[model samples]
Target: MFSRIDRYRWSFQDSHLPEVTLFAGENVAFDQRAVRELRQMLEVQGTMNRWSSHAPEAFPEGAGLQKVVLTPDFHKAKGIPVGTVVQTRGFLLPQAVGNDVGCGMRLHTTSLTAEQVLGHQKALIPKLRRMFFEAGRNIPMNRLQREALLREGLLGLMDTTPRSLQEGLWQLFHDQDLTHEAEHTESLGSRRARNTLGLEDFLGQRDFTRDGQIGSLGGGNHFVEIQRVKNILHPGIAHAWGLRKDQVVVMVHSGSVSVGYTCASMIREHLSRLYPAGLVHPRNQLYPVPNAEVHEETVLQNWDALNAGCNFATANRLMLALMVRAVFQDLEMPTDFPLLYDATHNMIWEEDGTYIHRKGATPARGFEAMQNTPFRFTGEPVLVPGSMGTSSFVLAGLGLREALSSASHGAGRVLSRGQAMQGSTQDLDDLLRQHRVVTPVDFARTRPDVAREKLKELLQEAPDAYKNIQAIMETLQGAQIAQPVAELEPLITVKG
Candidate 1:
């Protein structure tokens, strides 16, 4: 099954760099651009294989890279492929995780049905706007509460923060027992992240506006969507996960926002100075902090900062979900919002003693690997969301060793944002009307030219900019990496 074909051949032969592996299903053509990028990565050092492989000269020397794996959604990113998974033995690559340190997806199953939300659409939007916008005044958090949440994650927030400050958020935190929700969240929404580097001092020197960002959804593909479970592919697992057909679920796709970017920039700057002079490539903005070269203290500092960022991201998603709950409360609807799972696709994890960097890829540990959690019988839930106005999936991991137990985070971008903006001739109103996706943008109030440009920006994120999600999901299932459990169709999408 793994026989080499002309299409799978590497562009250049190198003895030192490991051979690039392609995992597309039979009859499926791999992305040529990604293949070329991988080939360029092999030629860059001739010693260490780069992850992105786009601009070989940009990568620094002696990266200590061990392996590079591309998912079915592989596509060209700034320097690396969006669906690329990079493994390193004794080094940490900043760019591998990208600027969004803990950018990820979170889903909460609600007692409210699709009918309730769709019926209340007229009243729901105003309340949602009040909770999401208006300075995030609905969900208030003090400096101390913000620090605790950042330092400790969801568990920390529950244990330390005052319950009186934000009753809605507090109620949401205790909606289900911490242990139950923690089992669903990656790293339990916080791994008791210790800050030894005084991130507080650094954050203070910067803009340092944690309260405002907590419940706010960041832009560029980030959204809080109301979706309906259209179909249950695996009935048993769906039942076990408390999901049913026609049930409403709130899905939040966001990240650490400015907090994460700030931490990543700081870490990148520190690591950049340590790069060997000639090793620094102008095109390669990524730098790896190898354990061998850097002092133990510096390594610890970087790790601490990264952990802090990850914790902040986890809390940020939780806060965003809580904000959604607040909207539900304001509308006096079914208030039970039990968390299904929270997982990060853009981050690094220490698995089996090797650091695996997953950029736009979800960790799909199978049943055996999740013995301690409720998913012991079923694998961890792998959420693969689609572009706006499309179907999203909930999958169970198969833990394919060849694919590093990872799946694509979303439908990989086929066209760049700029390209989509330039080429898009989509009729925004008609498209939305066709899909019945309610957005906050009031097209009627805006000027015609400005509205057209805004519509282009919206079209840039339309389904056309992405690869066929059905194809991507099929590729994952064909490769035995994950199997779809449930399919969700978006009813209402809230974007920044």
Candidate 2:
């Protein structure tokens, strides 16, 4: 059973596992199955004695679970819940980060106004589809550039790609712009990668290659939406972030698709190989790699794989933003899309000495953790995207230690995929029209069969599938976890 510990937090405790605190409102329902799975996963900690542990001098604290916290948008995922945060010492849980490593949100404040972008909506929608869905995106990268990006993230791209190569869509890779943009991004929006699994083709040739994943938004709730500032909750902070009333902003929600999946597969396979010969596998198929002398090498390799996928995901989001910029340029809008911030919701972060694994949860670091970045005074820009056709928000992290300095990634799903699919197609279409959202699927020219298939797919992510964004925001504020800087209303949404 769960009890309301406070206005912002609900507490659940099992005798066999650590207590889980969820930051949510009174209206949100708690998933008991997720809590049970979490307890079961934690119970495996007792079985660590089965594996031989050489006293790793490197990790003095050894390996053990430390804390578990759930964000306001917490929901049941496969084995772990989305919007969950787990902190551990001297160990790394591969399943904690899951397969979608580096999946996150990116926001860019544009020079154009709502009036300017909306006025051209009729003419701009097709252009956006052509650039995003069609083969109109021209991003050229040689093997060196590709390897650099996969190995070292955006910094690697800037260091290796020359001025001459930065043409067409590549022009957005200006050194100055990248440098400035990095200053605002979380952890500088990059991580050094040592392994490039399943990326041989893109890394074999010396000349430019046309890779499909770089600029593509992968499936399942990933989107690029154009929004206008709906309200200023914190004028001082909003102004600092260059947000104003009715100003247009572009938000991209995506992740490392094939690259992340491949990397995850390789890492999990290695874990399986390391498993002791006569032991039964964990029922949930989740494995945790302890920081021991015997497992140190494997841990390093796992980190390398994780970092590679993360770098690829970061680069992927960057390319998506540039694609949007290219579309605007094609329509004669000024190419002044300054990046507000880029932050990952799914990844592991090493803080001080503990490892914090966040799945569908964003880092809401306060001033101290962000002292060196442009957000030093305002704290990290926590981008919480709402559901399709709902109001999203930009919040400033307050760095609450009790909450492990984290916030929700988006409005959590209210209905399961199966339940959402059962809704009427007409209601889905009506929601899309009511919000003025544009999708790549052109129903006007497509055959009835094709349109039905597409509509079926889109119905799963309808706005009604998510919780109330206003309630979520209220919890965040009431909890003192993060303060809202501004609210964004969708102008046009581009779903993949």
Best by lDDT: 2
For each predicted model, how many residue pairs clash, with residues at least 3 apart or on different chains? 2, 0
Model 1 RMSD vs true structure: 4.7
lDDT of 1 by residue, 283-352 (tens): 4455556554324555666776677778888878887887777777767785577889999998888886
- TM-score, one value per model: 0.88, 0.96
Query: Distance from true position, residue 229, model 1, in Å?
Result: 0.5
Best by TM-score: 2
Assess the local accuracy of residue 163 in candidate 2 as a C-alpha lDDT between 0 and 100: 85
Candidate 1 error regions (>4 Å): 1-14, 26-30, 39-63, 196-210, 278-283, 423-426, 436-440
Q: What shift in Å separates residue 63 of candidate 1 from its native position after superposition?
A: 8.9
Clashes of 1: 2
RMSD list, candidates in order: 4.7, 2.0
Q: Report the C-alpha lDDT of model 2 over 344-406, residue by residue, as the tens digit.
A: 998999987889999999999998889888988998899998888888999999999888999
